[model samples]
Target: MRKREIVLRWHTIGLVRTGSTNYLIHLEAGNAFLEAANLSLSQKSKHDAATHYVNASLVFKKDDPKKSIQCLTKAIEIYTGKHISATSTLWIGPFLSITYTTLYTTKFSRVIFLVLHLEMGRFTIAAKHHMTIAEICEKDLVDIEQAIRHYEQAADYYKGEESSSSAMKCQLAVAQLASQLGQCDKAANLFEEAGKASMENNLLKYGAKGHLFKAAICHFCVDLINGQKALKTYEECYPMFADSRECALMKKLSEALEQENVEAFTTAVQEYDNITRLEPWITSLLLKLKKTISEEEDIT
Candidate 1:
């Protein structure tokens, strides 16, 4: 009867959804689960309690972020086995398991926790969490702006930790998004920094040319003179960049942009596309670049 009651409580907790008026009920159930876990010292019960904490946090997120954070912190502590008594985790037997209301309950709770941490100026511990949120935004939610925001924040934190490789990865993600949004100057600077950093790492040096090429393209969107200057600087920094097909393509596109020649740019892009596939993102940026040149010609 006691075990059946426990399972019913777990089921009741799982049924509560976000923004539902059952906030207090879920919180009480979560506390009861924790108490049961402590009394019985069951690992699975602890896990159930942690999951309940996460769901409860989500329920109160908008109304009371502090309380939400408190609940999420408890959930994380339980998940990581911190502060809980070691003996309380003894796996006696699987009694009951409650499926999460949302598949992303844990991930969402962590993201919310770190975002609040960021708002409160606690950046030191947010690097990994921010990166995780960034990936979730990019891959799961398909929110490019949020992904860029989180990636940029992660880059800053990574730089503080002296994790240059990780920071460069974030920079690359932001740069790609910036270029897609036609924020050419921001993209150009980030790509240039990432390229320079890549050139310094023996393992990443081969990929440096691709970064430089993208940077040069972003600069082209800003101005032909800037593009020419950037391409020259890239070649000087990495001699191998000058010998690459990307370098040849950039030179052709730069010449076209300088003369406001749309046909030449289109032909160059087509020739390159025929030899090597240009991904949709690259194709989109190229179209934007071509439009800029066309707009300039129309003005002339």
Candidate 2:
């Protein structure tokens, strides 16, 4: 008779609307009824809870998160009622944390919470979502170092998983960010790293341009030093040119190395004219490269 009464109560509770005050009363009564009757819900109940959680995630995606969180909490309660394992609990915990963190805001606490959420997204293979959150941290939070860290992490995750194009783009983004932060060496290293990864993955056709980029950076560095070493570095990079811009610039650089004065400059102009007939844009850059080379040569 008691078991029959408990079964009736459970059915009534399940049929009630979860959003109503009466539903809360039923839930409390159902818990007591289940305990008294020694009746654990079946696996079907747990599966239903999982389904509800997924549905709630979609519904709450852009809507009222507080309501979504309520639904998720109820779903979790259902799962718990069926005695779901701790591992499953771990899986659900991050989602709950994400929701709570979104609801609450504090000056110092927000930073910590966002980092936690970022780490959670990273661990879950949510690269696109993780990148978005990282950008928020970098821009809104003003945590440049943390932003770079997440960007690098996202790149590595993509690269390690064979997402070559995405990984390369992520790496490029990090390089650009580093450059903006006035960390030229770090940017150079990231570019070199991306280049190596591209080559090792047989993506050289896509990555070959990076070698020339590195050479340009080295050339700039050389100009800063006003030493023969800079010119030598440029020479080393000259052979890697597959682009018209690089090829033209290489010719201009070679001419500059040979000619040191106004007379040599006149000779270079003639040589440049001969080269420009083959490629006109190259001629335009040659003149600029000549000026740059001349200035550096004077300083040296």
| lDDT (tens digit, per residue) of candidate 2 on 1-300 | 554455445545543423345534544443433332233223223333344343433233233334433444444344333332322222223123223343334366765565555434432253443454456556656666766776777677676566777776777777666655656556656665655555455546455544445434434333434323433443454334334454454445455454544456457557745654423433443354466757767799
Question: Model 1, range 1-300, lDDT digits (tens) per residue?
Answer: 686466556546544434346656545544544444343334346555555565655554545544554665565455334332323322212452222333224466665454334333333345555665566667656777877997898888778767788889889999998887778999999998888888888999999988898898889878878989999998787888999999999999988887789999999999999999987888888898899888888888
Q: After superposing candidate 2, which stretches have Cα over 4 Å from the reference?
A: 1-124, 137-144, 199-204, 218-244, 247-300
* Best-fitting candidate, scored by TM-score: 1
TM-score of 1: 0.61
| Local accuracy by lDDT, each model | 0.70, 0.48
Q: Model 2 — which ten-residue stretch has the worst lDDT?
A: 86-95
Question: For this target, which candidate reaches the highest lDDT against the unseen true structure?
Answer: 1
